[model samples]
Target: MSKQISEITSHEIKVEGKSSVNQKSSVNNDLSVFADGWAIDTAVPLDLKKSADKDYHPVLKAFLAGSFSGTFSTILFQPLDLVKTRLQNPSHHVVAATVNRVQPGMITIFANIVRQEQIAGLWRGMVPSIARCVPGVGLYFSSLHWLKAKLGKTRNQDLGPLEAVMLGVVARTMSGVALIPITVIKTRYESGVYKYNSLGGALKAIYKAEGLRGLSCGLGPTLARDAPFSGLYLMFYTQAKQSVPKEWMQSPSAASVIHFSCGIMAGIAASLATNPADVLKTKMQLYPDKFPNAFSAALYVQQTYGFRGYFKGAVPRMLRRTLMAAMAWTVFEEITRSIGLK
Candidate 1:
């Protein structure tokens, strides 16, 4: 009887020991999971106590989608933009003519241009716009996030308004370098004949008439205009994000409203910032024969048309940009939310 009791006691000890080891293994597994799950979450790093933040990527996804947004928007509103340009530009005839009883809006102007130039005219500058906008959009968002993250790392917190604005300027400047040549293409194509028409025609005309430099017509004006406008856009977007309450970060229309608000501000700021460049871009594109480079064109505009030349088609530009931003951000947020991705 004593031997039987002894055996039972030994068996009980083995069972307890096994249970202890199992519990320890479970704890270790849980720790491993915590490590894997939270390691890459940008918001909450695995080791929040530790000081390592992540670097942002090339942001290709944002660029591709955003370009689609830009392209579609342009297609939808090309006519409006055309009319706006015409109103602002006003050939000697347009100026004297605009003052008369009849004036054309977007639809009418688009139809008129098409009637004269054909359907392809509506898509003028498309190639250059696409080329410039793709890289530009990618660089802008990626830089913005990278800068914002870097700045936020100072406090190990999220982006604040000031940091956001500075980041925007950096991103926009990067995009501007790529945008110059493309701007020339779009300008020439939109300007009409003698200068150029289609993308191919514009390239040849620019090549034969003025050489490669002619393609960089409004680069300086574009930079000057883009910087402040970009700064304002980032500032406004940052401000809008902050305005939303913490709980509403994931909310539907709330994000939309914030984005729209930011878009409105960006549109206004960009319109004001770029009015001069827009006129110069249009004039240089159309009248490349007269002014070859951006500097010469700007000087001519300032000297010939005075300050007013700087802001010829401010109205339509402002409206189109505002619409673009509003639509882009709203769709961006909405799509991300629906897909459980952001």
Candidate 2:
């Protein structure tokens, strides 16, 4: 009878063990449901949504952090770009006998512009530059972020370097198109070829004087300089992105660091690739009558100044771009994180 009692207790113990296993399974299922809900609330699937959250307030964020930022930075450092352009423009109308005593490189160019045009002269094309540049820049960033998310199916919402660059192109092209007219105007203004109180005035002046085509006067030179330059800039940026560890990419703050480096590398590369176009653009902007064809301006700069002159103002241009890029990227990240997107 005692043996029988012990055997019954053992069977009961086996039954209790099976019941515990079922209870454990139920807890796991409940945990999974909770986890899924949390993931959805946190926004795990959507990349653009994440980017928007990262942006904080969308257009306003972009305005302050992007276009406005870009424009302000451009203005702050523009004296350098201006002096560079002047030194590199390769003036053709040399007075027959003067021997061209000493061609101003950078310092003389700055002094002469201030002496001749005033402190404001250093920022000659600033209004037009910002006017055209802001809108284009706005389009470039917003569109790129949106389109890359939609097309790439980047489930993680964290873009790799290739993805970032492809998206960058989207924004760049749209911005490029929007800024075409403004670009022409900015070019002219920078070269001291024309002046207008507003972008409208410049457009009106161009239409009245040179016709619609004149508004797009140096399209070939603009495209020639910009397209390949764009490729080079993005490639370097992508490489930078790729080179960094994935862990760094996970940190939103790292975005700014990456962007700053990209801008510096891009500025250097762009200064070289597009120097020829820059020289041509400067010529057409200042003396369209003198250089009816973009090709002619290219030839003139090449023959007169040689290759070194082509890279004129590169130092300041790089400085401005690097600073702006670093600031913009850092600001964008801060804004995004402040909004709790991070």
Deviation from truth (RMSD, Å), model 2: 9.0
lDDT tens digits, residues 19-84, model 1?
Answer: 999999988877776776754333443564232213313254455455655666656656555566
Candidate 2 local lDDT, residue 42: 56
lDDT of each: 0.64, 0.64
The CA lDDT at 244 in model 1 is 67
lDDT tens readout by residue for model 2, 149-190: 477554345555565556655556666765777887876666
Error of 2 at 255 (Å): 5.7
lDDT of model 2, residue 164: 55
Instruction: Give the poorly placed runs of model 2, Cα more than 4 Å off.
Output: 1-65, 90-100, 153-170, 195-197, 246-258, 336-342
